[model samples]
Target: MTVYLEDEQQFFEKHLGLLEKVEAVINQCLDQEEVPYEVEVSLTIVDKAEIQEINLEHRQIDRPTDVLSFPQIDPECIGKINWDNLDTSSCVNYDTEEIILGDIILCDEIAALQAEEYGHSLEREVCFLVAHSMLHLLGYDHMTEDDEKNMRQKQENVLQCLAILR
Candidate 1:
């Protein structure tokens, strides 16, 4: 997996250690899920205001959230992608031969606050958010109670596998 990370907010500069850990969490998720295609994910860290504007524009949610995921492929397409028959010759960046997974936007301000509220380090909170967003990118959703439970369990397991406990 290739993670193209950008920090639009300066908050992440102080917590540089968390960035590496977050990337590892994403990679671990993809590997554990046995994703057949080489994947590329874009991750951006923003402040609360920036994330709030994005949330409002994209999701019609006026409030800021810790993380948001925008998937590139349809949920059904994700499951049906034929890795063996995939013709990467026409795809952009075919040299890398990676399927563009999607984008993950994270709110550093919210993450920091949640870390304090949840009584955990910022590292853990960021890792959790990354893991959660990675699942979303992979067509996971929490619209129903059962679905939410399953997604939550998956996120916790991924975090645990990385030894990123609360």
Candidate 2:
């Protein structure tokens, strides 16, 4: 899997260790779910102002969310997608065997605030956000209680594998 990260905010320190940790967590989640290793994902870290602008432009919320996931797979095209159960065979390319997962945008400032409110480290909060965003990229939606439970469980499992637990 390939993770392309872009940091537009200066609030958090961008380090190789943090990037590697996030990558490791993503890899572990894919491995556990038996997803293909040829997927490509993009992660963008922005500040509250930037994220709020994006939110207003895209979602019309006019507020900054901790994370926003832009899933490439549309429901009609992907067909009955679920995060907990992934089908790698359906995602394989004819030759390269690669899958374009999707893109995720995270507000670093909001994440930091949430981390403080949740009484956890920034690293843990960021990791959790990444994991949650990844699940959304893979076609997870928490529109219902059951769906929320499933997605939350998957996020926790990925974090636990990375030794970043609640």
Query: How do the residues 64-132 of candidate 1 rate in per-residue lDDT, one tens digit apiece?
Result: 999999977556543344445655554335768788888999998898999999999989988999899
Error of 2 at 41 (Å): 0.5
Clashing pairs in 2: none
lDDT of 2 at 114: 94
Write the residue-wise lDDT of candidate 2 on 56-143 in tens digits. Answer: 9999999889999887665532224553455656654556666767888998888889989999988899899988888777667898
Which number leads on lDDT?
1
- TM-score winner among the candidates? 1
